[model samples]
Target: MPWILAPRRHRVAAGVAAVLLAACTSVPLPPERPAPVEEVRPTVPHPPAANAVERARSRWVPVDWTELPGWNDDRIAEVWPALRASCGRPAPGWAEVCARAMLEPPADDGTARAWLARWLQPWRVEAPDGQVDGLATGYFEPLVEAVRQPRGEFRVPLYGPPAPGTMAKPGWTRQQFDTLPAAKAALRGREIAWVADPLDALLLQVQGSGRLALTEADGSRRLVRLAFAGHNEQPYKSVGRWLVERGELTLDTASWPAIRAWARRNPQRVQEMLWANPRVVFFREEPLPDPSIGPRGAQGVPLVPGRSIAVDAGSIPYGTPVWLDTTEPLSATPLRRLVVAQDTGSAIVGAVRADYFWGWGADAEAQAGRMKQPLRLWALWPRGARPQ
Candidate 1:
């Protein structure tokens, strides 16, 4: 999905002493309630004539592109049964489990409460005053604040600090994170809760605070703060210049001050702009060599683009090949294709299903958002190996 950077909000003037005091006093809180869980119903499409278990043990090989579309649908359908059989039903209290799972380890019940307070303090909830319970208040506000703070210090960047801007290089787009092995691995085996759907496996990655010193292939380094989903997933050329071309603003519009002014004058428009441009991203305090590594060495596997899958890496090694088949919107032809499991994510933690990051920028984000369909999957592993 596209990662859009939300325009920074304007800040009120504050004395340096006050700023220092605030920094010293503010402590982060963990989320209180666990993430909500919804029920997922299994849907079995027509079964594949061949046994999927047998297919999974074969060597990686390419299938005809034309036949792939049909195969993908069949694969998704067949794999769901296997996934259900392995993972079993979602726990009776799975929501709490999922929510608590998102927290860093070493968390206890009391720590979880404090963390919720720190995380939820910044959110603007619209529920009634009485309905605004302690849990909601504690969880969202702190999380939002954590997102606003700097990567290391957990302090928000000051407006007048005049930080230096980093230069961008050619051929490196923001969407490259989707293809990174580390990011994929981090997402594996984790269940994601969606706003609208209980069983939606696609998780939205939002903005987080942190600075990174990224080393390019050429060994050059550049420092940048994480703004994961801040900007609309549109290409800089499309959204950035589009703003200029449409007379919404100029290339040299007043930096943060001017942008904040515009946002104040057009709050709804600003919200629309932000909602339209969301991108998926991963960020943490210290720059991780690979964002994909999870709590342990477990790897997140990416489903093939334009296909659906159910995966259990304990049973299937990374880099295994798979085939997927599905139908498309209003098209008579089935969408079928071959893919290599190259990435993974938290929302992809199903024994029967997986997600495919469409890869960088606006066009990719647009495609990823619209992908909801039934599928059939077939795995290709080594011969004579038992399924993990």
Candidate 2:
């Protein structure tokens, strides 16, 4: 009994000491941590800038010449005979010559090429010096100097129809011919005169009197009266090229007829196609002549009297008023007037928009239909020198 009591206290103390030693040896500390890294971003690229000339060139689109309704094979064939006859005897290399002449007629002197190079800046193709086997290959020259010095002249609008003295042919009509009531109504209360003709009966008068006085080096003075008729609504070169580049037409295939034909085939696309072109031209006092012959052919839009004028708009500031005068359609009478060049059009390039004086009758209609020609232009600006 005495031995059991002494051992109990000693056993309890031994057990407690053993437990404390085991707890101290069991646990361990965590290792030191590392720092985080940041993510890197990639760079982006930009498009290159366009140069001035490139920018200018970009404005033009190619036209589908064959799509034009006027370009019938029969019509082309018919015109070829007249062209050949006018060109005289065909040389061995005549085809190219004929093509060039048809595409771009030569000046009266037969020394200058009529096709002006848009990129060349005032230089146009003159007659080529060397022959491609005796015929001229073609040449280039400055347009401002090579052509006859441009005399300062303005174009005037013609209204209604041809006056009594201007009738040159007999009146003719066709089944498809129908006058627009809007046009006929617009003619009322407008200040204009009328004329009669054997062909398309009525005529409109826009310009009354203006003259061109050309002075020769020999001191001789020649006064020529400017007469003009109808309006123009076509684009020049640059805008045409732009249309081609934009997939509207192919270069080889994009002639006036091709485009016109395409338009006829897809009448719904006409407005879209035209709007995409962005280079349409409108004339106030002059008319575009039809390339076709005969009385029954389609005529272009007649000029809206007084309120319209032709404009490039890109070059000339919009809303500027201009004075125009040109020779009368099919006649030598001078037409002149003041017009507001307030609009831009696809075909209205180089400051040459003719405002027509819309008159009455078939002769006027025919005259309006038959009025279009290459013309010189002058632009007037306030506090700035007039531009040519």
- Model 2: how far residue 205 lies from native, Å: 24
Candidate no. 1 TM-score:
0.32
lDDT of 2: 0.24
Worst lDDT run of 10 residues, candidate 2, spans 1-10
Question: Which candidate's TM-score is highest?
Answer: 1
lDDT of 1 by residue, 81-176 (tens): 111211122222222322432333223434533432232211111111111111000000001112222234332221110112221222223333
lDDT of 2 by residue, 1-388 (tens): 0000000000000000001101112111100000001111112311232311111111211222222222222112212222322223222233345445456543432222112111112211111221101000000000011101223331121233323333223311111011444333433333121112101010111111112233444556443222222221122122223346667666444432344455567667654443432211111221113211111000111122322243444433333333344444456554433333332322233323332322222333333323332232222222212122
- Model 2 residue 91 CA deviation (Å) reads 54
* TM-score for each predicted model, relative to the true structure: 0.32, 0.23
Q: Assess each prediction's global lDDT (C-alpha) against the native.
A: 0.27, 0.24
Could you list the CA RMSD of all candidates, in the order they appear? Answer: 21.9, 40.7
